[model samples]
Target: MLIKPVQDMLLHNADHYLIPADIVAVVQADNNLYHAFLVLTKIKYSKIPVLDNDGHFEGLISLPLITEQMLGFDHLNTEILMHMHVSDVMETHVKTVQAVSDVEATLHLMINDPFVPVVDADGIFQGIITRREFMKSFNFLTHEIGKQYDMIEKDFSSSEKTN
Candidate 1:
């Protein structure tokens, strides 16, 4: 079946699906690696958004990025590394989607990232939509469609019997 209608229906209430920024764990660009590491450990999140001091969205940081940098050092300099800023290792090229974006656009952005950061028209950080959430919504829509198909089949069968 065509998914445009489903996409429209889902995107109509897209704001409701967003995980607001307030609830998300975000590290500041100037934050030390030690702090970033601690937050990542505490949250147990693979990746977390980075923000600047002005509360503008910066990029994303992941545990692997930290580990990759750490691996380059023959001698683990915990003290020096601890002072490294998040911006030094954070990925600047990030995929972002607007809060009002359609599901198809959001899904396309999410293909390369675990979660797509949601922003406002003014480029203000709003929240994120994770792959998990998207999958859950898609599954629900498919399940509901299946039920509707079953009902239609039953109705058709009943009409045939009557005729």
Candidate 2:
């Protein structure tokens, strides 16, 4: 049976690969660093998006980002977390993609990030397109292509033997 055309295989929009915003775990920008750390630990995620009170995508916060501030010459200053905010150390200037963006572009961006955050024109947090999701689709596409190639080779071999 035929599958999707090669050009169509990987060109789907970012929304096609989205892990929607509602299901995503997010920490508020104004949340204290300690709370952010707790959330990351509880969720067991390396990083999570940060949102503002208006629900705009601010950036991402991670355990490492939280701990970085505590590193000192003699000991970790864990006390800093209580006084700081997620915005104090969260990574801003993250690369993002639009929902209308092509999967090819999102895949390229994912090479540098575990997930590419999605946003609207107004910077509203839409969701994320994760490398895991992209790879699932990519693996399926390649597997289907390989199957077609094997079938073609088998047909060619049969035709040659008949001659």
**Global CA lDDT computed for model 1:** 0.78
Q: Could you tell me the C-alpha RMSD of candidate 2 in Å?
A: 6.9
Which 10 successive residues of model 2 have the least lDDT summed? 6-15
- Candidate 1 — which residues are off by over 4 angstroms? 12-15, 72-75, 146-163
Q: Tens digit of lDDT per residue, candidate 1, span 9-121?
A: 55645656789999999999999888888899899998999999777899998988877666644675557558689999999888787764557778787777778898777
What lDDT would each prediction earn against the true structure?
0.78, 0.82
Specify the highest-lDDT model's number.
2
Specify the poorest-scoring 10-residue window by lDDT in model 1.
146-155
- The number of clashing residue pairs in model 2 is 0
Tens-digit lDDT track of model 2 for 1-163: 2244653665443346888889999999999998998889999999999999987999999888898888999998989899999998999989888773456567678888999899988999989988888887777777776654444435555557755
lDDT at position 92, candidate 1: 89
Q: Candidate 2, overall lDDT?
A: 0.82
